[model samples]
Each structure stands twice: as C-alpha cells, then as structure tokens.
Target chain A: MLEFIDANCRLGRGPAPREGAPNTTEEILALMDRFQVRSAVVYHASAQYAEIMASNRRLKEETRGSDRFFMQWAVLPPVWDLFPDPEALLDEMKQNGVNSVRMFPAQFGHSMKRYAAGALLDTLAAHRVPVFLPFDQIGNWDALYELCETYPDVRFVLCSPGYRCLRWLVPIMDRCPNLYVETSNFLMHNGFRLFCANMGADRLVFGSGMPEASLAAAASQLLLSDISQTEKEQIAGGNILRLLSEVAL
Target chain B: MIGENVLRGEPFKGVFIFDIHAHIDATSDFELTDSSPDKVVRTLDALGIGGACVSSILSIHADCPLGNLHVKEACSKYPGRLYGYLTVSPYDPDTDLDGAFADPHFKGMKVHAAFHRTAINDPRYEPYWEYADKKRLPVLFHAWELADVRHIAELAPRYPDAKFIIGHGAMRTWEIKREVVKAVKHNGNIFADTTVSVAYDGAIEWAASQLGADRVCYGSDIPFYDCRHVVGKVATSRLSDADKEKILGENAKKILDLP
Candidate 1:
C-alpha cells in the first residue's frame, strides 16, 4: 500500500447538511487514519457556502496544532475588498501557513475568466501557489481554457471532475501544462492510466472528498489502476506534495 | 500503507465476489471502453470476482431484442462466469419478454426508466412486472431517484415474489437513500446494489446498518464504472467480515440461486 495525501477534503459544516455525522476536525482525522491517508490538503466547507474570511479563520483555528493538515484558503473577487491588497493577502497566507487557494466563483456569484480573476490569479501565479476549482464552478472548458492561457504560470487544479468531462478535460490537458485534475469522483474505466498516459502522472493528484465522498474508493482507484507503482505513488501523494513545495509561500 | 492491500495485489483474494450489476455492450451512447464479454471476464478475473450478472447496453440503450441476443452470446461464451439479464424498454412493443426469459442464461430483467422515458409505475411496465413476479425473477432497475424508489415501493408489494434490486441505490441524495432503506425494511424482496452508490462515504456501512447486510448486493456497474474501485468500497468499509461476505457474494447467490 502507498501513502495517500487527499487533495480535496473539507472541514467545518456546509450550508446543506449531510446524512452522516457532522464533518468536524476530529472526525476527519479519524477518517484519515482509517484510510491510511498520511496528510491532506483541506479547505473549510463553510467557505463554500458562508462568509469567506470567517471560514478561513475557523479552518486556521481548527487545524492550528496539527502538522498533518495543510490549509487551503477560499478567495472571493477583489472588488468586494475582502483582501484590500492581493500581495498582502499572499503575505497573510504565508504567515498563516496557507499552501494553496481555492475559488468558488459560481457559488459566490462571480466570474473566473481572465477579466474577473486577473489580479488574484496573477498574484498566485507569481507566488507559484496553486488554485483549486471545482469542475462545476469553472462553468465550461472555454472559461478554463482562457484562464489557463492568461495565467500560464498559475497551477490550476480541477477538483473532482467526473467521467463525462474527460473529452474536454483531455484537450485542456493538451493545451495547458500548468493544469491538473484531482481524483475523487473520477470513476472512469482505466481513467487513471489513460490520464497518466496523456498528461503524465505528475498532473494527476489524489483526493478523497472526505465525509461526503469515500476515501477508500478514491485511494483504491489510483492504487488498483493499471498505471505503474511509481505512477500510483506520484498520484497518491507525490504530485500534491510537489505542488505544495512549489508554492513560494 | 500496510492494511488490506487495496493496490496491486488481489484485494478480495479469498472472497467470493459476485458483481450483480454489469453491462456487456456499450453502457452509454457516448463511449464504451471495454464492452467485450471476454474483456469483462478478464477484468473480473484480475480482481478476484467469481462471477457477474450482466445486461447488454444494446438492450438498455438501443434494441432490447438485439441486446438480449448479445446477452445470450456472452453467457454462452463464458458459461458459468457470466449470467444474463434481459434488458427491456416498456416503449418497445416488440420486446418478447417471455421468449428472452425462456433462456436459462438469463437470470432476470433490467429496466432503465430514465433511458426508456417511462415511469416505472406506468401501466406499460405492468405486464413486465407481472411476468417477472410470476417467474420469480430479479428485476434490476436504474433507480437513482426517490421516484424510482417509489416505483419499487408501488410494485414490490403487488408482486411480492419478484426480487427488486434497486440499481445505484437511488444515488442522487440522502433523502432517496433513506427511502431505499425504508423500502427494503418494509419489503423482504427489495434489495440495493453497490454500483455508482459506492462514491459516497459510509454509504455501504450506512446501508448495511439500516437495511441489514443481506439486503445489499455488490454491483460493479463495470465498463460504466470499475470493479476494483466498487469492490474496494465494500472491502474497505466498516462493515464486519461476515456482513461483507453476505454483500459480496452470499446475498447475491441466494437471490440469483447461484451455486
């Protein structure tokens, strides 16, 4: 068995309640232990549906003592003056131990094209900090294509893309070297192997989408995939580790 | 990194795994990665699955009559390894259910209400349900919503002899899953399969805790989904080894009367 570093997990509560127990930090840690996940790159679920800064503060507070957890912050449009200066926000992120940032433009009611995301994307690109976007929130491949074209230096990770999105996702991988996708709900047959063949194993990251999604299923997908052991290790934890290492912050 | 070995090695090595929901032809109009029965059997062999109850995508998506022929062919090609499910659309008036069911290869019937553009409760399905009930055949519905579960709720009591295996465990929401658990609780003949439903965390455990292990069966939804990932969901779940045994093969064997 290989070590897993889940790239798409959440802490705190979302607006819509889930069926099982609340997604608390203690619960997630237990889940990580059960699934043999050594570490995780996590975002606060409240950030997806509630106030961004408050959620970020809560995430930092909850994960303060644990070295096993890597924090990912949520970003709103700069027009709201959420963070007055983009550079200052990066500095704040560094101080707070934030390794990556995520965007929920559609949920937060904003656009992520070069026009709306220009400043934030530029700053993150300069810092080499990765940006995580859900496939549904990214609108369409054209929007992603434009963003990838505009900020070629920025590492854009598409979170939990489904099997149907493969046709377009393949082309996006072909067009953008900086673009990557996380494996959580990626249930396509021979998907991991095919993705590694096309984009290289380095571009595919492991994600469990804990609480809401199965860690065992996600880990097994990469583990049992036709890809080589080295490829499995890269997808399991090495890829995300490399992405986090590249972050100047 | 050192538990059950979900990677490389056979995860269900000693376990008798029986995949209840699988397809022989293309699953969707868009793409069918490995539709050949030989490929399906090979994939199953690699993952340590003893057998699979397969339907033809041609029957579900295109022509049921033609697809059922492919089902027969797959069963003949791999005698004990592959069991057939006669795929039928209520809209296809020419569908000879009796003729298809007459084949010993076919163990049951598969209906996809979403693709057929008909509700399961529609009068058109009455004949199929009635026939299936009389034959004591297991009917696997593409049940992904509460209404689909409602369809099972409506028909299960009426045709008590027919085994109703809700496909995908009504996968869309927790509400639907609650209904599925409720339906299985109320009806002894009602069951759920672990197809696309495995994506949800604790789904199998939740289902087992709520409906008992015997009411749930392992289904790969292969070609559309993967066997390794689907089986891993059950293998790695919090359910007891005994309960896991029931879901993986024992329950299916009892339902399908497999040796």
Candidate 2:
C-alpha cells in the first residue's frame, strides 16, 4: 500500500450550494490517516470559496510545525487595490513554502483574462514561479499559456485538470514543458487511463484534492488502477516531490 | 446501537436497520469513500441491513443527469436491496427530467441547489416544482442556513400542494434561524431533517423544537457526512425514543412516501 499526495485541499470554510458539516483539523487528519496520506497542498474555505486568503492563513496556522504538509496553492487578490504589488504576495507565498497559487475565476467572479494576466505575468516574471488555475476554464488557460511562452520565465501549474481538459491540452504540452498538471478532479479509472495513455505519466502528478477529497478515495483509485506501480508512485507522490522541490525553500 | 455512538452499530437481533439517507461515491475526489454500489450493498448487508437508500457523486457538477441515470441502472440490478433518490440539480440543463423523475425505479427526488448555483425560488426551475407536485413525490433539498430558509420559505408556500423536506434544520447559521422561522410560519407542508452535522450547542434541540419531530426527518448525508456518526448522535440525543425512531427511520419513510 502506497501513501498518496493530495494536490488540492480546502478547510476552515463552510457550505456552498451544498455544505458538509463543519470538520476541525483533527477530524480531517483522522480521515486522512485512514487513507495513508503522506503529503498535501492545503487551502482554506469560507463563504467565498476562493475569494479570501483564509486558506493561506490556515496553512500557516495548521501546518506551522508539521513538515508533512505543504502549502501548494492559494487564492489571492487580483493585483488590485487590496494587493498593489503581487511580487510581495509572491514573496510571502514563497516564504510560506507555497510555490504556486490555485485560482478559480468563474467561482471567484473575476475572469483571470480580465485583470490577472498582466499582474500575474509580471509577478511570475519577477518571482519566476507558477500561477495555478482551475483546469476547465480554457480562455484563462490559453491566455496564461500564451503569456508563459512569451515570457518564458513564468510557469503555469494547472490543478484539477480533467481527462477531457488534458486531451484538449495535448497539442501544447510539448510547447510548454514547464506546465504541470495535478490530477485531483479526475477519477481513478477514467483519469488514470487518460493520463496514462495521452499525457504520459511523467507529466502526470498525483493529487487527491483532499479534505474536500479524502485520501482514502483518492488512494483507492490508484490501488484499483491497472497501471504499473512505478507510474502509480510517480503520480501518487514522486512527481509532486520533484515539482515542488524545485520551488521549495 | 448504531446511533448510540461511533463504532457502535445497532445490535442486530434478526431485525434489519435501514438508513434512508445513506450515500456512497466510489471515485469521488472529495473526502468521499469509494464504496462502489457493489461494495456498498455488501457492507450494508454485513451490517444487517435489508436495504439502504442511496445517492451519488454528481452533486459536485451537473453530472447528476448521468450520475442519477447510472445510479438508477445500478439500482435496478439491486432491486429490493438498494433504493435510490434520483439526484437532480435544479439548474441541470440535461435533465431529460421527466424520464428521470418519472422513472419507475427511483424512489423519489433529491435537490442540491447550492451545487447547481440556483435558489429554490428561481423561476427557471418552476418546471421541477410543477413536475414534483404532479407526481405527488416529496423532494429533499439541502438547506444549510437562513438564506436557504428564506429560499425554501418562498418555494414551500407557493407549492402548497408539494411536500418539502428541509435538510440541516438544526444548524441554521447565517440567516438560517430567521429563514426557518419564517418558513415554518408560512408553510405547513414543511418538514426538517435532523442532519445538521454541526452548527453549535443546542442547534439540534432548537431545530427539533422549531420544526417539530413529525416535521423532522433522519438523514446521514452519506458521502460528505457519515451514516454511523449521525445515527449514533441523533439516536442518543435527549429526544424521546419515539422522537428518535421518527427521525431515524419513520420520518424519512413518511416524507419519501415509502411503502
């Protein structure tokens, strides 16, 4: 039985169109241990799913002492009046061991295409890091990828990119090798087959998107997958280790 | 007994225990477990369940159309053992809808508006309200707090002909308290479920008082919440055994119009 890496996680927030009962951190970890989770990229949730920086704040508070946790990605202000200089924010994220930031434009209500490209392009240029975005919204992704190629300095980390999204993105993976895909939203059987067949397991990384996703459910997918153990290890934890270590302090 | 505490399932003395609100997702990314329908049935059978009512993973997306369809097909194979609530997002564009809700196999309907990004009174979904009324079927809607209470209030009275089950009645946070008070005041067709996993102290008691035991139902919120956990807590609450029995099974049977 191999331990898993959860690329996406949300906590400290409450309900949505549907809400789960409130769960404390200790309650969450007990569920994780049932699945044998080795690492995770934790985020925070409140009324606004990704509107606030609560995930970042919670990451510092919860995982301050534990090395088993890593702050993968966080939602931040769109380089606006709240945050004028994104470099400082990037610096702050880097200090907290967050190399990437996950963003949701549709749910967040501000299309990244509208304001994020320039600020994030500049920030990534200055900090030389990746800006993680939801996988389905293609407009932002195409815009971000165009910027990444143009800048050649910044990287784009796409989280929860579904199997269909990956298939749609096959044409550009070679062009932007700097792009990394976290397999959180994709299921074990379907996502496993798609990533193994089309994207190749090397570009594929394992992430359960825990808390919101359980380590057990995520781990079970790999356990049930027909793929080799080598591919499983890389997707489960090894790939994340390599990707984040480059940006790790 | 199952609801008496965690890790404590109701003792089986040749009597079957059925949890109507139980749900399971095999490959769901959220903290959901993968007890596939096969595994789910087996687990339940092992726990001395004659049958269990279930839902699916499509709540996170509009996939409810396919998810429910798949679940119904899966339910057909189980027939007597696994009953299902045809999951619907009020805003699901693909709801072949009539065929789905009217399907002979599905026990009833479930509405997760929060996932669908619509409020209960959103006129775009009047079609569902009309259909549910026509079928004389009860629909379970996830109501987390006061905002939902207001939303439910508007819809419940308007559909005086419809039977509505209010989920999470105990932990009315935000405006849930205000919303629920207004709802119960205006609508007599409203029933609440004691599945508010956590709101604060006395939330469950308050919800039971406000909604009335007859108006409250038992739900485990299977995938995100837990069946065993809810069973233990509610069954052991300060309520009378009659109240506990009503919440644990009787209420759901009545709301769902179970045979």
Question: What DockQ does each listed candidate score?
Answer: 0.51, 0.03
- Best-matching candidate per TM-score: 1
Which candidate number has the best lDDT? 1
Q: Superposing all C-alpha atoms, what RMSD in Å does each candidate have to the true structure?
A: 2.0, 9.7
lDDT, candidate 2, A64-177, per-residue tens? 466666665555445446643576767777666777566666676554442555666666546555556666543545765674576565566677654334334565676887
lDDT of 1 by residue, A43-99 (tens): 888878777877887887777578889999998668766554688788888888998
| Model 2 per-residue lDDT at B62 | 56
Q: Model 1 interface RMSD, in angstroms?
A: 2.4
Find the 10 residues in a row with the least total lDDT in model 1 chain A: A14-23
A42: Cα error in model 2, Å: 4.8
Distance from true location, Cα of B215 in model 2, Å: 9.3
Docking class of 2: incorrect
**lDDT (tens digit, per residue) of candidate 2 on B81-129:** 7777777665565577677756565766677777778776667778777
